[model samples]
Target: MKALRISAMALLGALLALTSFFVGMGVGVRQVPVPKAIPAATPTPVPTPETGVDFSVFWEAWGILEREFYGEIPPAEERMYSAIRGVISSLGDPYTSFLDPKQASVARQDITGSFEGIGAIVDMKEGKLVIVEVIEGQPAEKAGLKSGDIILKVDDKPIENMTLLEAVLLIRGPKGTPVKLTVYREGLEEPFEVTIIRQRIEIPTLSYKMLDGKIAYIKLREFNEIASEKLKEALRELIPQKPVGIILDLRGNPGGLLSVAVEVASQFVDKSPILIERTKSGQEKLFKAVPGGLATDPSIPLVVLVNGASASASEIVAGAIRDHGRGILLGEKTFGKGSVQQPFTLKDGSELRVTTARWFTPSGTAIHGKGLTPDIEVKAGEGEKDVQLEKAVEYILGLRREGKSDVCEGCGKQP
Candidate 1:
């Protein structure tokens, strides 16, 4: 089954399944346009409960505004959009949101990973806009945009009350245009401004190299459609060298398609349940690993690296590897985001992304709002080298020296 899994920023935080593109770093597959508008179905009115509550007041206000409002009132369709936004906002779910026709069109481009923007992933946290990931070789990275920088303004406009999508709209523009951003960084008393030239960004999926001449180190930037295939190709090239172990780095990865996550986990796990999905009605569905994975051999020692930015599909893969004892998890706690969202197109060509279910690890641990904790907690210092990666490499080399095969008791065991 093709499950729709997403995080916050389509290319950044949450996942939008339309084109399965990366948000923050700007990577993904081909784009697919939103479906054509369908005819509106007849409404089936429900009888009001006997609780004595009346919704007639809403209609009365609408009628009064239509009759006596001084300024030019918006079209009925435009007003309907506001009404829908109000209703969805009442749910108090940041993930469940409405995208208007224009926004919906941009979302399609976002998931496909090609757009005119600074190429940085960002999200709203506690009313503040925060950078999640900066795409390598992109304008954001070239401008020295770093993860964790809190955005204070866009184009000199205060972003205090703007939604993440609002700020995104302001930040992105025609290619070669400049967008100015003011951000607050830790240890700095005052905020600073940075001008970035927007350009067409194409995000790369994975990067790998052999470490210590024996261990294969693969860094998965995002879980896009081609992630698993790229990983398989990387393994094909690395396995011939007979590496002692493998380190899968998932730091700063937001999330993407659910099906892609399953494919990624299958590469490391053999014939085991990867994750379980629980719907609102309490129906449970199991996602198991498929046969013929590139790295399913239990004898190969494995390690996974994660951080606060690793979420959704990334968490699924990390949680499976840890729960099945196939590898060791090392890094900071993951970004807790476990809910699933499905998109429903409206008659106006807009879209509604609604949260429908929650996902659990193989051991039945709920990941929604509660991120996974790594077995070995390693922190990376600010402006310092990647200490966590170095630690993973050290651990894997030690296992190789000990002549260990399959799994190490201190790290993980074979399933």
Candidate 2:
């Protein structure tokens, strides 16, 4: 019942829908920050009287497979891990998932915002692993990987039936290792292979620049550990420039740490209870804005950009901004992913990521599967004209002259 470390709505962003384990939501097709400091609790066996479920049938099937199956058996650990996955999957919740030690390690490192993999964001579309977004200047782009490229195989092995985690494991390797990807381009009739040398990718948590109108343009890519730190750095550099307004872009952000989300929201929303966490039992908790915020000034005027993929911690920040009227929520409705995940590490270092709670905006609107609606909806896609951004800029420039707009009914309400 305690506040979870990974996210109140974090790790389930990417992997649950088969798009989560890429090494690039800050890094990986992402979800869930593994709270490393959490001591691994020893596994407790459920008493037969507690559940009253038959266990003999599982053993009987295992014995049959071991005795009569023609193929060699995997290690007992693999079988056990697979069973754990089955147990979690039976819950019928995509966010509730299990990761082996290696996958768990990758997820933990994702919080640090760097990992060893071909840099790209991938999604499972129609049962095929497709390359959605490749990190620029990284191995994926360097190897001529393009968006919409369908990956058929990794290192000559077809990725058929492999989970996103499994496929990501194949694509990820130690730095300097080579990974061969058989790709099927939309225009190309034949599937071709591209060998990429995996390297240490420093996922950019954010990038900020002073726009032409002297506005601060900050694009947040993830809520990794260093996100707030990087934002502080950006503020120190940009605030002095005296920008007319700020544009905090959260498009394509897949979410990360829950604590980091609160910290990021604190930068703009100078109010208590930046977010709310509600367990299934209807118990509620609050995450308040912390002190020492660098951008809590009400006159600065803010606008946030979000799209369908803006999830978890992304929705947290966007929701806070809208609830407090700290910014105009522009772009389409956000990726509705307001559920919190608690990562439980086992003795063998595997992790069980369970959906433990649901989170809401400061105003108490649920975000899970029902994304935040934009105050001003503008649709835009990647590589196209950024009409949303242009609209945001125009709106902010107008706000500077007209003063605070009643963008939200709860605008400036200390609710």
Candidate 3:
């Protein structure tokens, strides 16, 4: 059918792209420019009923199979499904996936608040499964899995030629089940195996406390599916304390869902736009602050916390506040991952995550590989609070006093 042909063509295009990537035959990072816009995904078309000689060509091989096959003939449905799978596998984008009924159900469960697994965000780096971010308090983190860790094997299965998703399926399983991961650490000369028992992991979204009883300290862990809800709950509890200022921490938060980030930013901005999603056709979708969204007043002094690991949606929120002059950023440089990844499902229930567009700040500054510079830079230290947080608190309180006697002299800056 025409629709089937078109679908196959599109799928072929994707396959060609991925094949080039794997062959190391594609353009380099600098040569392959980031998408300036987001292209809308094409709608899948319906196959048409075959007729006449065309119909004969369609099942020519199937008819031969039934007539000449020595063993019991296979069902037509199974053959059809196999063809569909073959087409999907040709695409080569592991994140772009197709899920059958069973796999789809498992994927839904995995996206829920908790799942049994070694908590880690994985990506294909140099043809190997690389840990992007290990969830805090999870098995991987507790087992000393760090960002950029290279996983060479799981049990006896070497990860060579396997995609990131394939590695994930091999590693994650029922709670209390054991898995051995062979990894190559940066400073270690030998590859070591870490045996870990999988457990149900509930990702923590927000961590908060009152710093010096006045500055509300909030560290947003990540913008997962439920992050915005958790953020509102955290703020509801903290706002009543009447803190002089708030430190919105986004250090090491490898961003989750974009919607979660938009919702979280809405809480602090009332009458201004938060971000704009620009599509390939130059269509811009503006995410604006909801009416009366005074969850935090603009007049209330504010400081944003960021570091090397703050990326994607974290950068979005930080860039929004910094560009709008809603708050001062305080920390070292951030992880510059400003592209948006849109997940596509393939026929085999795997996912193809493709970077669709480069995100820009409100002021039109690109944050890709060029993170936000802090208004006040602070180097972190052991046995002391993060120097960034300390500076933000001191800055807010000092500004409140406006040149009165210093309250905390050890902070270097006046008060």
Q: Global lDDT of each model? A: 0.73, 0.72, 0.58
Stretches of candidate 3 above 4 Å error?
1-111, 120-137, 141-149, 160-163, 341-358, 379-385, 403-415
Candidate 2: worst-modelled 10 consecutive residues by lDDT: 8-17
TM-score of each: 0.87, 0.87, 0.67
Cα deviation at 392, candidate 3, in Å, is: 3.0
Give the runs in model 1 whose Cα sits over 4 Å from its true position: 1-3, 9-21, 24-56, 70-75, 406-415
Model 1 per-residue lDDT tens digits across residues 280-390:
999998887877788877678898998887878888888888878788888898878888777677877688777777888888888777788877889887676889988
Clashes of each: 15, 13, 14
lDDT of 2: 0.72
lDDT of 2 by residue, 1-415 (tens): 2224332111111221222433322111123445554563334333366577566667778889999999889987799788878887778776677888887777666676677778877755556777766777888888898877888998789986555666677777788888888999988879899888888877766899999889899998777778889999999999999888999998777777778888899888888888888889999988888798888787788889988767778888888887887777888887677777777777677877677788888888877767888878898855767899999999888877777642556443222
Error at 373, model 2, angstroms: 2.0
TM-score, structure 3 vs. true: 0.67
Alpha-carbon error at 227 in model 2, in Å? 0.5
Q: Candidate 2: TM-score?
A: 0.87
User: If candidate 1 were superposed on the true structure by all CA atoms, what would the RMSD be?
Assistant: 4.2
